[model samples]
Target: MKSRYIIASITGVSLSLMGIVGAQAYSGENLAKHAKITMTEAQGIALKARPGTITDEELEKEKGGSGLRYSFDIKGTDKVVYEVGVDAQTGSVLENDKESSHPD
Candidate 1:
């Protein structure tokens, strides 16, 4: 009876962990699809347009929205950092602004 209980407990724990992992994977895939454009493609476009490379990229959840927002950073040749936003659904460039730059 004790052995059976232990086996059952272990199985329950394993199943719970599997469920958590599966949920995370599903969320990641959904974010990717909603973004419309892949990370690689965004990086390529940023590199071509901006002087510096892409430092970071992420999908942000808005307060009252169904789709996610894609945000990225690009450091220019003058060492200026710019924040760029792209529409997740249409892959349209929303905003591009220089946040900061190296002092003259």
Candidate 2:
């Protein structure tokens, strides 16, 4: 009886640990499992926010001490390069600043 109890306890603990791991894996915070917005969606949002053509884009989990966002470098027809950030969760523009004459 004691051996059966011990085995049951171990199984319970293992199941609990597996649940925790699975929860973490599926959490919205983990981009690999939950992507609120795709790269194409992010690019579209950035282009709309900056009114420019996206020349470069990257998925940023944490940038400059900020939360998950998509960074985009855009060049308008006027030749001004702009830096833009789209929130990964809400697909909103977080930052849009002119990044010198050079592109990032």
Candidate 3:
């Protein structure tokens, strides 16, 4: 009985860990079908345009970049945050500007 309990506990923990990992890996997965460019590709493009560590990222439908864009907020080596938007369909850099003091 004790061994069975231990096995069940282990299984529960493993499932919980998998859920957390899956969540992180698929942040914008729902919007993926609408994007021609993959998230990994967008990340590379965003980094090149801003040259910083990505603090936050998401695939959102905004008023640019084929109406579907991958947005990234990167913290520069100089400690400033920049918002870079990449067109999901064309892989073009749509916006690369300093993040405003008041973010939307």
Candidate 4:
């Protein structure tokens, strides 16, 4: 009985960790339900506005179009980091600008 309980506990922990890892695909996924444009569509819009390799992306609420936007941090081929914001509801490019370097 003790061994069975231990095995069950380990299995539960493993499953929980797996869930967390899987959820890392996107931040603010909870807000996805309110978004008219899917994440894939937003990505395309952002890339078209400013071509680059996306380093980070998230859906967030802010004072903007529909109050919700998909923000992407893209590293350009020139090595500059650019922040692109796309409206979650309309798929419009809200912001496309170079990212300022912050002091550590």
Candidate 5:
């Protein structure tokens, strides 16, 4: 009986970890909406910043509250990667910090 319980616990932990990993993979409508901006606009903004290659984009929830924000990853001219954030509702650029990356 003890062995059976240990096996069940291990299975449960493994399943929980899998759930976390899946959640981190970026699959959802909110994220899709944010990433759906026109490629022209994205390239225009990206050109100004001169972040090398655009990698990925997603919609992120605000930290202190409920709204949404758009974030994109870009390989910089200096060879370092960086993230950019824009307000989803107002279309205003918010922050360029890496910590701005998050799920909605």
Candidate 6:
């Protein structure tokens, strides 16, 4: 019985580690694989919605596929940063919020 329990624990741990490793490999800079819109198009869409220059971006999808969006961090001409999420499927802005970027 003790051996059985140890085997089960080892199996569970291995599976969990595999899952994490797989996910890390899966998300490595291949945001365009599942996006219907091009990264430039998405950047344009986000700029039109919020009006800023994109400084950074990443495509994100929830583990279960309930959410998929492109996250763009933009810096306005006046030096304010904005975080925008544009839907990967529909090419629409899902959400936008300003972030504090203190300039010294």
In order, the Cα lDDT scores of the candidates are 0.66, 0.76, 0.89, 0.91, 0.59, 0.76
TM-score: the better of candidates 3 and 4: 4
List runs of model 4 lying over 4 Å from the truth.
Answer: 1-6, 101-104
* lDDT of candidate 6 at residue 91, scale 0 to 100: 86
For model 2, state the Cα shift of residue 72 in Å. Answer: 0.4
Clashing residue pairs in all predictions, respectively, total: 0, 0, 0, 0, 0, 0
Q: What lDDT score goes with residue 86 in model 5?
A: 56
Candidate 3, 1-104: lDDT as tens digits: 99999999999999999988876554577889989999999999999988989988998889965999998889988888999999999999999988996253
- lDDT tens digits by residue: candidate 6, 1-104: 99999999999999999987776432324666777876778789999878877877888885322277877888876678888888887887887788655352
lDDT of 6 at 71: 79
Residue 47, candidate 5: Cα error in Å is 4.8
lDDT of each residue in 61-82, candidate 5, tens digit only: 7662226665667767776667
What TM-score number comes out for model 4?
A: 0.84
TM-score of each: 0.55, 0.60, 0.81, 0.84, 0.48, 0.61
Per-residue lDDT tens digits for candidate 2, residues 1-104, read 99999999999999999988876522233463345787778778898888878877777676542477888889876788888988877887888898866733
User: How far in Å is the alpha carbon of 46 misplaced in model 2?
Assistant: 0.6
> Which RMSD does model 3 reach against the true structure?
2.7
| Whole-model alpha-carbon lDDT for candidate 6 | 0.76
Q: Which candidate is the best by lDDT?
A: 4
lDDT of 1 by residue, 1-104 (tens): 99999999999999999987876533244577556677666556556556586676776765323356566788778777887765566566666788555242
Question: What ranking emerges by TM-score with the best candidate at the front?
Answer: 4, 3, 6, 2, 1, 5
Candidate 2, residue 32: Cα displacement in angstroms equals 4.9
